[model samples]
Target chain A: ELGPMIVTAAIGQDTSLEDGDILVVTQKVISKAEGRIVDLRTVTPSERGLKLSIETERDPRLVELILRESKSLIKIDSERGIIIAETHHGFICANAGIDQSNVAGEHMVSLLPEDPDGSARRIREEVAQILGVRVAVIISDTFGRAWREGQVNFAIGVSGIDPILDYRGSLDKQGSVLKTTSIAIADELVAAGEMVMGKAEGIPVALIRGYRYQPSAGGVAYLLRDPASDLFR
Target chain B: ELGPMIVTAAIGQDTSLEDGDILVVTQKVISKAEGRIVDLRTVTPSERGLKLSIETERDPRLVELILRESKSLIKIDSERGIIIAETHHGFICANAGIDQSNVAGEHMVSLLPEDPDGSARRIREEVAQILGVRVAVIISDTFGRAWREGQVNFAIGVSGIDPILDYRGSLDKQGSVLKTTSIAIADELVAAGEMVMGKAEGIPVALIRGYRYQPSAGGVAYLLRDPASDLFR
Candidate 1:
C-alpha cells in the first residue's frame, strides 16, 4: 500500500480524464505512494551531517536525511537557511528536495521519488489502462530558481509527451528562422496545475484538458543538461 | 507607437478585465512598445564584444548589443553557443535576454527593458486608470533554467501584487509547521498566461480573472536575489 497506487478509479466521476489531456500529479503524492518517507527517530546523523546541522541550525536527523539523498553539496547559506544540493537524482534543489511539509506525523518527512520519470511512466501506464485513453503525465514539484525569489512548480518527471516543444528552425510570424524558443511545456503545465492544486489545498492531481502535445517515448531525462554544458553548477 | 501602450482597451470586450484580475503581458510586446529594439546595423562591436562573437560563433553586432545590455557575463559556452549573462536589471538569462524571434525585422532584435519593473508599474497604472479597477500586472519573459532544458515563462516584472505568497510557518494539511513553501504566484501566472497566449499565435496579453491576490506596492525588484545569496551564478 505504501508503493505507487493506481488512482484513476479514485478520481471523481464528473472529471473526465481523456486523450490529449495532461495529468499533473504532485511529487508529494508520488513520494508518499513510493514510501519515500523518512522518520526522524530512525536517522543516525553522521559526523558531517551533525556538523552541517550545527552550522545550519537544523535538526541533525534532518541533516542526515538530506546528506543521504544528496549527491553533492553546492552551497550552504546559514544566514538564509538555504542549502543548495544536487540530489542523487541529479536535481539541484534546496535541501535535496527533502521536504518536511504535508506528512502524517510531525517527526516524518518525505523525500523526492528516486526515479521520478520511472514513477511517472508507471502511473501514466496504470491510468491509461484504467481509462483506455492516451494522456501525458507530469510529476510536479515546487522548486526555487537560482536568481528568482520564491518557488514555482516544475516538472520533475514527465511521461507520454515531449517536455519541450522545440520551435527552433521553425518560421516565426514574419518567416524568420526562430531560435531560443523551445518552450518547456511540461514546466508550464506544472505551474498551471499548481494554480488548481494549491499549497494548502489537498488536490494532489489535476487534469489539464484541451491542451494538445506531441507524443514522445522518453521522460524528463532529456531535460537534464550535461555537466559540461551547465554553467550554473 | 514604438513603446508599450496600455493595452486594456485593445483586449477583446468579451474578456472582462475586472478587479482582482491579473494581466500577463509578454515581454516581446512590452519591449517593442518601450522602443527597446536595437538595429544590428548600427551597433559598433567593441574589441571584447568582437572576441566574444568569434568565440561564441555569433554576429559581432549582436554580441555588442548583448554586452551593452549585460552588467556581467556569467558564463560563456563557446561550444554550445550559449552566453549566460546577468542583464543590467540583474536577470540571469541567455544572451542577456536579448531575443531575435518575433521581432518586426530580421536585422532587429529586442532588448529587455532597462527597467522592467518600472515598465510594469506604468502599464498597471495606465490600465487601472482606463478600466477604473485595480489589477495586478506581470511582465513575462521565457527563460531557460540552469539545470533544466527548454524554457518556461518567468515574471521579469510585476505590479500591484507581491509576487510571492509565503507559506512559511503556516500549518499544512496535517498541522505540520510548513517552511520553505513560498510560492511564486507571478511566475505561475506567467505560465498560465502562456497557456492562453500561445507562442506564434500573436496573442501578447492575457487576462486572468477570479483569482484573488494581496495588493502590494513594489514590483518584481523584490524577486531578484542578492548576488551573494545566489549560488548558481
Candidate 2:
C-alpha cells in the first residue's frame, strides 16, 4: 500500500514537509489500499432492495448493496436517480459512498473504509514513524451539499489536527465575544487539496505547508452534528 | 481598494504569477469597497422584522436589515437564535451574509453586495487591467452547511473559471463513463484559500497558481440549482 513515501516521492526529496504540515489523502487510494471494494454481482437483492430497485429503476444487486452499507435512508429522489443515505459509519452521501468510478472491473465498486478515523490515525502514525515529522492527516471524499449546486471534498476522517477551530470565547476585532464561529479546518483543507488533486487526475495525495493549526488527538466524529442540534437534517 | 498591486507588494517583485492562476478573494473586502456596510442604529424595524426579532432574540434593528436584504427565510431556530436566510441575490447564508466582526465600530455591520457576481467581475477586470494578466476570480464567504458542524468558506461569486469540471461523458481509468463526477472547483478553491486566510488573520486574499481550469464568460448564477431540480432546500 502507498504511504507517506509515495507523497515524498511525488513531491520530490528536495521539498521536505515540516511539523504542522497537513496531508490530504483522497478516499480512492485509501479505499484501494484497505480493500474496501465490493463486487456488485455477488450481492443478492433483499425484499426491501427489490422494492427500492423497482421504485428507483436501479439494479437490484446495487440496491441491495446500498441497503447493506446504509444505516438510514436520508433522501430518495426516484425520478432523478438520487438516493442520499447515511452509511453505517455515520457518513451521509449518495449510495452510501459506493463508488463505481476508477475501479478495476465493471462489476466492482468501492465502499468507504469501516473506520475512517482509525484509518487516518494509522496513516498519520505510519507517516510520522517513516519521516520523523509530525503531521496531521485528513481523509477526503467528494459529496454533494444541500442547497448548493456542486460537490466539494470534505474530511471524512482526520487525525492530529483539531477538526474544528473553536472561537467561542475569543474576542473579535470589535471586542465582541465570538459565538458560533467554529471553523471546520479539516473540510477546508480537503477542499484546498482538491484544487491540486483533481478528480480526473491520478494525484490522490497533497501536502499542505506553511499553514498553522492546533494539533490534537481527534477524529471526524467531532465534526458531525447531533441529530437533536441539527435542524436542517 | 486593495488590488493586484497590494498582492505584488506583499509577495515581492521577483515573483510572477503565471497563466492558469486563480485568485481567491474574501467577500469582506469586496463588500467593504462596494459600500455594503449598514449602520444598525439607522435601521427601522418592520412589523415582520419586529416579530422575527423577538422570536430570534436578536436586535430588532438587525432583524429589520436582515428582512430587507433577504428574499426568503429558510430556517429559524428561535431557541438557538440562528436564522438561515436566502439573500436577494439567491445566496443562502447566515443572516444574509451580515457580519459584525472585523468592522470599525460595534454599530457598523456589513452585508453581502447587491450582486456578488457583478462585484467579482469588476474586481477581476480591475486586477486584469492593472497586471495585464488573465486570472479567474472567486469571492468567498464563510457559510454553515446543513447536516455538517462548523462553517467553511464557499464561493459566493465567481468569474473567468468554469466553476464546475463536469466529467459525465469522460472515461475513467477502468474505461467506464463517469456519470456523476462534476467537481466544484470554485468552492474547493475558496475552502483552500481559507487555509491561508485564517478567520482572525487579516490576509483576505490568496493566490493559487499552476492549476489549469477552462476559461469561461459566466457568473455564479449558473452554479445554482433550479428550485424544481432541488429536492433539498
TM-score of each: 0.92, 0.95
lDDT of 2 by residue, B1-233 (tens): 55655446545845565456788888888888889898898888999999999999999999889889898998899998888888887888889889887777879999887787777777678667777777788899999988788999888888888888787888876778888888778888888888778776657788888877888888887667777887777
Give stretches of model 1 more than 4 Å off.
A1-13, A54-57, A78-81, B1-13
Q: List the residue pairs that clash in candidate 2.
A: none
TM-score, predicted candidate 1 vs. hidden true structure? 0.92
DockQ comparisons of all candidates to the true complex: 0.72, 0.69
True contacts kept of 2: 0.71
Instruction: Give the range where candidate 2 chain B is weakest over 10 consecutive residues by summed lDDT.
Output: B2-11
Model 1, position A128, has a per-residue lDDT of: 74
Docking quality level of the chain pair in candidate 2: medium
> What TM-score would candidate 2 get against the native?
0.95
Model 2 superposed RMSD (Cα): 2.0
**Candidate 2 — which residues are off by over 4 angstroms?**
A4-17, B2-19
Clashes of each: 3, 0
Q: What's model 2's lDDT at A49?
A: 97
